[model samples]
Every structure is written in C-alpha cells, then in structure tokens.
Target: MSDRRMSNAITRPRRGMALEVVLLMLVMFSVIVLAGLSAVTTISRTSNADYHGARATYAAEGGADDVMSQLDAAMQDGIISGEDLANIQSPVVSGYRMTQATRTTGVPVSRTITSGPFSGLYSLNQPIDIEVTARDTSGNRATAVLSVNAQTIPLFQFGVFYEGDLEIHPGATMNFAGWVHTNGNLYLSSDDVRFQSNLTTPDSVFWQRKDSNNRLYGVHINNAAGTAVALRFDSRSLSDPLFKTRSQQDFDGRLMSRAHGVKPLKLPLPSNTPAVTLVEPRVAGDNSMVQDVKMAWKADWHITLDASVFTAYTAADSNTMKANFCTFLTQERSAGLALPSAAMCARIFKPRLDAFYEGREDNRVGSTLAIIRPDLIDIHLDTLRLWSDSAPAARAPRIIYINVINDNVADTRRDFVAVRLRQGAQLPRSRVAADTGGLTIATARPVYVLGNFNTIVWRPAAIIADAITFLSQPPNPNMDARTSWPSATRCTGSSAGWCDVNQQAADMNTARSTNVNAAILAGHSATPNDFMRVGGSQPYGGGLENFPRFLENWSGATHHYTGSLVSMFTSRYALGLWGSGVGGQYYSPPTRQWSFDVNFRFPERLPPGTPSVGTVLQTAFRPLY
Candidate 1:
C-alpha cells in the first residue's frame, strides 16, 4: 500500500512542472513579435522626414535661379519698373513650398553710395539680393540666399551700318546724320566737306550754371590726342541762394539757328590762345548706398586753370582723335558729373575687373582710381565722298569724329598726354592738338576732339585713278549709280586703306597708360557728385554720322535734353561730357546734392510699427499635477 502512494505523488509533481514551462514559452514569443513591429514603425517615420527635407532644399535652390533669370530678362528689355516687382511670384516645387523677397533699384530705398562718380552710381545700382525658405508637410525645412548685379546697354541700334570703308570722292556731296566707324584712315580734299550745326542748340528748354560747389559737374570731352577735357558752367551764376534747386530744375535752355550761315556764339579765351591748365578740385560726396541722402561738398580746392600755363609743351594739329563722354547711372539718378568728388564712388587703388574696364595690367599705377587700361583699341573713320566737281564747297560731306581720352597721373603737377607721333603720316595729330591743348582736362575723363585730317597729294594721275575706283563702287553696292566730278590738281579719300591706321592706334594705346602711382589718390575732404548729362552734337563731331539719331532731335538744350533714352547710351563710353545752357537759358546747379548712410538695424523683437509672426506647434497638453 505505501509503494503505490509514492508513485502517485511523483507523477502529480511532474505534470505541474510541464504546465509552467509551456506558459513561459508563450510569453517569450509575444515579446519578440512586439519588438519587430516597433522597429519597422521607427524606420518609416525617419525615411519620410528625410525625403521631405531633400525636397525643401531643392525648392529653395529653384527660387534663387528664378530670380536670376528674371533679372537677366529685365536687362534685355531695358525697362525694369515697379510693375515688375509686383508681378513676382513664389515658386512651388514637388513635395515642397517656397517664398521669395526681392529688392530692386530705382525704388525709394534708404541706402546711398557716395564715391567715384555719383552719376555713374545709377549704372552700378542694378544689384539685387534674394533669400528663400522652404518647408513641407513632413515638417522638413531648408533655406538659401543669392545676390546678383547687372547692366543694360544697347549693343545694336537700328538703321546703323558699319560699311566696310567710306570714301568721299573729291567734289562729291552727301548729307546724312549718321556715324561712320572704320579701322582705317580719314582723308579730306582742300576745303571739300563742311560740318553743319543743328538749329535748335542752346535753346530755351534746358540749361544750367556751374558753381564752385559743383565744379566737377559740367561738360566733359575726350579726344584722340589722348586727352580728357571738362567744360563747366559759370559757377558764380548759380549761387543766388534764392531757390532750392531740384536735380531737374537746375539746367540751361537750348539755342536755335534757323540759317546755316549764322555762326554760334563763341567764347574766346582771355588771352590770344593761352596755355592749357590743369585743376585738381577737391571733389567730395557720399555713395555708400545707392539711395542714401547725404550732402557732398568740395571745400578749399576750387581754383582756376589757366590753359596758357600748361600748354607750353603742347603741339597743334587737326588729326587728334575724340570720343563721346560717358557716365554710369541708375534709372532714378543721373551721374553727369565732370570732375566729381572723391566720395562719389568707391576709390579703388588696384586694377580689379569688378570696378573698372581693364587695360594693360602691368603699366597701371593701381591707385585710388583704377586707371583705365585698354589692351585693344578701336577707331572709326567716316567715308569720304568725292562728287563730280561742280563747285568745290557746294558738295559737303559729313564727318564723324570720335576721341579717346585718358588721364595720366604721372603728370599730376602738369597737364597734357605726350603722344609721340609717327614721322610721316598723312593725317597730322600735331595740328589738331594745337587747338585742343588749351582745353581743360579732368583727371580721367574723355573729351570729343572734333576736326578734319586734311592732305594734298601732288600725284595727280594716281589720285584721279583711286577716285574713279571709289566713286564707281556703287552707293548701295546693288545699285550702279555714278556721279560726275570736277578735275583738280589733288584728290582726297577718307578710306581705311589710305593711311597707317594701325600706327595711329598704337600711339593712342601708349598714351593712355600711366606710370604714376599716387595721381589717383582720393581727396580726404572732397564732396560727392551732383546730377548731370553727357554727349552733345558739334559741327566737327561726326554729328549726323556717328550720332544722327541724337543730333536730329537735339535743340542744343542742357546735355540731358534728349531724354533718358539718349542718356542711357552715352553713359557707357570711356569719357562723356555734359554742358550747361541750351538755347541761351541756364540750368541751375544743385546746391544740396546729398547722400545718406545705409543704416542696417537687426530686429530687436522687430520695430513697433511692424507685426511679426513665425511657425509654431499647433497645440500643447495640460495635465493635472
């Protein structure tokens, strides 16, 4: 009976142990399944966040490219207005959202730039900055920023043709207001072509007077003799202290001449052609930001230049070259100053591509003003028309003269660009330099030196033969029209093949360089530049030839008389000039030309008049403690 009881107890305990082992196995399986599911969920959430973040970054980059494209388009159109800014739209890309903000020039901004030429600040003012931020539903975000600068200049004009070589055959007459540019030479018969002046110059519409404060604001000229000259208004006339002058209000009227024979009023120098003079006026201004409002002044350096004193070494000739004066400006501001203050634009001491037109790098002084260094030079010559000799003077040919002006700081204490001429070129630069030597030259500006290069060849038969070939070439090339002519002992042709154009071009290149290092140093107390205009028509200038479009409507008003369209074109040349008084009326000078500093203030909780809000979480949970 005892043996049977022991067996029953052992069997019962074994069965209970087996039941506990099965329960433990079931619990372990449940825990393993739950861990696998939790790992999958975490991976899915991380992958979604990464995908959205990538899309946001791409969207921000897209915004920056869109803004750049818009700016380029505006440059081509030549018109960037407030409407353009209003039409800007935000960018939307796949799986992301983006926003953009832009700041354009010509608006009432609070920044100013008061260095170099204030008038040119307008041209350099076409700079814009953009910032973009992007976010997506996945709570991913990205941001980017970009800045750009651009300029608009008309490279091509309508109805203008750079015909291969223009030749005015002896005794031929052609009249048109157009410019002719050639890489050749210019020739004229004995008193064959005479330049005609427009009737409406110096009229009543535009005029201004120069003053000591605005000495640098006046007419500037560039000549092939490698000289830069300035023509200033009578400074004493504009300082009446009577009226506060606006940029547009201070100007001269245009002058008109109905008859061709009536000569324009000429102002003779105080002495019988005095020596040339050089004046270093203390020009001052502020150009820190494009739209800053601050007054510029040039005190203690306003003095007169007696040309007789400086022209002692200058030679005279008619073959000296000339070019249209140019300035850089913005849509709302005019950079028409002649010898502006030091503060008008940034004073660069080295030759950098961003600040100036680079020339030969080694010869440059690398001073405060990055002196213009031109590696390649261009020259234009109008064709000479030799018509049938009916009456020599009866047939008139139009000639356009372009000048290249450069300021050599090496001759700081003196004036004149010593251009060493070739031994025997038919065109004589010395003769042209004679009349121009007494002209006033700004430090680095260009002035128009208009005149003819005349020659008389005794080889009667050779001249006659060349004339025939030139006259018979056909005016339109497709048309076979020929004109009759009179016989003379000499003949003339303004053809590139006639003179050594390359030699002349080389001489000009050499004259433009400077060996002096300190001539371009900025004045410590110079003032900023005021508003002005550039490029005017002159009889000797290839007036109708080079600038017929400008001359046709020019009434000889202050330089800006042609409107903004003309102003934009002239502001890019190497040197450009603007004169006061048109048609006898006077434009007054701006007594209060000012530029202010750019005040950038970060948000200290933002200004009071401004409301600010940004992204935040949707809600919060409040639990009882």
Candidate 2:
C-alpha cells in the first residue's frame, strides 16, 4: 500500500511539470508571431508611402507639361495675350491635386536662335520658365521646373525655303550657296549642281524629276574637305535603313531628309490654308486664318485705283507721298481724294489700259491683248524715292502693296496683269535699323523688272509676286555697258506712263547681260506626269534655271543675279509652259550667273517688315522641389 501511494505522488508531480513547460513554450511562440506581424506591417506601410511619393512627383511633372502646352498656345498670335496667360494653370489630374504653378516670364523679345536646326536666324522669342507643385491623395508632394522658348523666325533668313514641293534641274553647272530647306518633297536632277550649305526637308529627296522623268544626274553636296561629293543612293535605290546610314556617313550629316530624321520647318500659318495666300489680297468668304499673315494686309503703304481719278489715302500718306496720289486701303475714293497730281501720279505708279505683248502668255491673235485695269501697274521706284523726300518727316515705307480694280473685265483679250519695278538703281532708304533699312514690295500681281534693279547701294530688298520677269537691257544705242544701266533719275521709252519701258510692249529678242540683286519669293508651274503627256516631250515651265522668268534671247549673255529664290506655289496666272529654246516658243534660257547673297545673313540687312515662321522649343526641364 505504501509503494502504490509513492508512485501516484511521483506521477502527479511529473504531469504538473510537463503542463507548466507546455504553457511556457506557448507564450514564447505568441511573442515570436507578434514580432513577425509587426515587421510585415511596417514594410507594407513604407512601400505604400514610397509609391505615393513617386505618384506625386509624376503629377507635378504633368502639371509642368500642361504649363508648357499653354506657353506654346500663347504663340498663336505672335505674342502672349492676357487670355493666353489666364489659360495657363495647373491641370487637375484624376487622383492628384495641384499645389502651385508659376512662370518666370511671358513677354517676347527679339533674338536669334543660338542652337538647333535654325541657328543664326533672328526671331521674336519668348522664354518661359515654369514651376509646378502637386500632391497625391496620400499627401505625397513633388515639384518640377521646365524652361521653354517660343520663337517667330523670319522667312527671308533662309537662302531658299519652299512651302511646297521644290524641284531643281538646272542644265548648267550650278552652285547653291545658302541654307536650303523645304516643307515639301524635294526633287533634284541636274548635269552638275553643288549645294554649298546644309540641305534640309521634312519630306523625301528624289534624285529625279517631279514629273517622273527619272533622269538621274550629278547632284552634289559638300564634304569635310569642302569638295563636292555626289549623293549616290536615293530613297528608291536603297532601303530606308541603308540610305540613312550612307547619307549620314558620306555627307557628314549635311543632307537631311526624312530618312535622316529631318523635321519640317514649320510655316507660321494655319494648317488649313495654302501658303500662297500670304501674298494675296483678302477676298470675300476667304478663310480668315491667313489674312494676318498676308502681305497686302501688312503693308504700311497700300495703293489702289478708283474710277478715273488717282487719289492717295493711306493714314501714313502724309509721311510717304506728302498728300500726293495715295489712299488708305480701307478709305473711300469719293471723299475728297488726296491724289497725286496727274504728272506725279503718272510718275510713281500708274495703271495703263491699252494693248500690249508678252511672249509667254497667249492664245489671242499673235499673242496680243488689251491692257485691262492693272494689266500693268507701273511703279517708278526712283521717282517715288525722290518725290517722297518732299516729306522727310514721312516714315520710310517698309512694304508697298499695289493692285488694280477695274469696273469691267469682259474683254477676255489676253494681256499681262503685272506690276513692274524699274528705275530702281538707287532705292529709297527704309525707316528700320536707324533709317538705313531696305525695301520689300509685295503684290499678288505678276512682277516685271525692266533693266537693272537694286544694283547700287546694295540695300536689303525683296520682290514677292506671282511671277518674276527680267527685261534685259540688251546692248543698245540707249545704254552701252552694264555700268551704263539706266540712271535712277532717268528712264527709257516714252516719259508718259503709257509709253515708258514700264508699260510698253516687249520683244523677246531684246536682252543684255543684266545683274540684279534681291530676294525673290514667287510661284512656278508644276510638271506632273500629265504635263508631259498632254504637252508632249517638253518639260513644264523652265525648271529652276528659269525660275526668274526670262523674256529675251539670252544665248551668249550671262544674267548675274545675287539673291535667294523660293517658289512656294504653282503659278496661278503666269501660266506659260517651258520652251525648248530651240524653236521660238516663249523665251531662251540665260547663262545663269547666280549666287546666294551672304549679306542676307545679317539681321540689320533683312528687308523691313520681314515675316516670320514660329516654333516653341522645350529648352530645359528639371525637378525644382
């Protein structure tokens, strides 16, 4: 009985010890589980915080992007408007809140692009530095800074810029010495053409003609050694990848095409309208988008004809003609007209209504036609210059717009509707650049140049017209050498407006080796495949060689021309086809002694009221907070 009791006591004590040990282990395990749970919770909270912080930073960047977009929109008017400024605010993102948005400057200033594609060109630039702060719903915050530049680049700065397809196929050895760019496709085919500067375009570059003649010729650009190197592979000949590789390696990255990643040089106009509207008059129902850019609307001196009397009416007339025959573009003619005397009116710019001859335009008997109103708007630059001095206080005329309005047009007798600039040996000084600026004459009418023009003093000048014709002063009894060019104070043909060389009939056989210096922005006809099929064997309009229309036999004569040539549209009026110069068709081609004037590279040398194409560049960006 004693042994049995001892065993029971021992067993009971052992059971109690085991139970105590089991309870202690459960307590330790609970402590370990709680610690692990705390660690996991902390990690989860840290990751969420980091993710929200990143989201806030992106939101701030988004706000900054919106500010950039606003800055760009501000450039539509060529300046920042009060409304444009008000529109620049921090955008509301779906889950983020904008804390702040600000800009350093919104005013525009005249400046030159220091870098990028259009460096060395002057423009009106507005620099903006923007900062934005935003926070996500989690209260994370971020800030970003962005710097942008909006620039309005003047078109004259380009040695050659075409808003449409530009084709050049000169038969002779040609050297184009200037930066050349096109907003459209470019076709180059020639015996020998050397581009002395960078050639850029957003479109493709073909080695053949525009009408698909497929006549490949020696087209060249400069290499590092300044030697002419031929461009061999075209878009058709090779694949895109290979062509880009070869052009960049071979041309030293000078020949920029779509394959080489060339971006379009934007024309600062609406996307809906054609670029030619820049030089035309505002017509009824015409899209209003282009009026602000038109040369007619921008002219400081606009002249028009009314009834039988020639009256002047510009608000600036007291400054230009000193109350002579001139009128405001919007002023009515019947209200006590301030017209130039008959003699002076007939001297400056006079409209002729008579019969005349032009070799290219025709269908009438022997190509003769009646001169309708403004069939010929004659401008005597010398006469205007000397006469305008009558009012020295008058501001220098930067741009001159002249067109004709006739009450009758039922004649249908083909005639040359043109504006001629003659006796321009010494042009009037401009009011810009300390009264030493140059002149720019714009008209939707065809432009004709009788004899030498802008050959002296060499001020900056340009002619924006429908078609440009050069009436050479062939060696004649009236004028001897090139030096004997008509004096600024003198003229040929009759002194009367109707009979002077400015308005008389022209002969294709009369031409001399002439030298003219001015930038030419005009139009030319296209040579589509249809042109060859319908016209047969003959090329459409004299390629780039005769872009400046020739009306004389330039067989052995050399036409020395120094200027930029930009053909932006198909000819709307001077619809004459190219002549082989073999059988007498229109006019013979001149031995073109042409060069791009380097003087235009200077801002001071640019013609007054020079128009610009605009762009907004994202210069820099960073995190400000």
Each prediction's RMSD to truth: 26.8, 6.9
Lowest summed lDDT window (length 10), candidate 2: 328-337
Q: lDDT (0-100) at residue 422 of candidate 2? A: 68
| Tens digit of per-residue lDDT, candidate 2, span 1-625 | 6999989988999999999999999999999999999989999989988888888888888888887766665554344444555668767788877855555475677777886556656787877677788876667888888887777777777778787777788876777777788877777888888888877776777787776556665899897567788877677787767777787688776777777655555444654556678787756665444566787776766766442222332242133443333341222222232334556755576443332456565423243453322345557777777765555335346677766564233443423456788667677765333655678888877888866678778888889989898877533434323244443322454332112344334344545678788888888866654322354443555667777887656677778888888777877767665663223354567677777888877767787656666666778889965
Q: Which number leads on TM-score?
A: 2
Candidate 1 local lDDT, 1-625, one digit each (tens): 6988989988999999998888888888888888877877778777876777666777787776776566444433333445555666776676667777766534323222232111112222345555667777766788776655433211111011111111221122222121212111111221122212111211111122111111222232222232333222221234322211311132211111111111111111111211111111222432221111111111111112222322222332111211111121111111321222223211100011111122212122332333332211111111112220222232221111112234334642223221111110011111122221010112212221111111121000000000000001111221111122111101233321112122121111111100100000000100112123233322121111222111111122111111000111121222212221122111111111111111101221111111110010101111111
| Candidate 2 wrongly placed segments (more than 4 Å) | 1-32, 52-107, 130-143, 213-215, 234-247, 258-274, 282-292, 306-340, 350-356, 363-374, 389-391, 407-412, 430-434, 474-507, 528-543, 577-584
What's the true lDDT of residue 293 in model 1?
Answer: 10
User: Residue 566: error of model 1 in Å?
Assistant: 16
Model 1: residues >4 Å from true position, as ranges? 1-4, 77-87, 94-96, 104-127, 137-139, 151-625
> What's the lDDT for all of these models?
0.24, 0.66
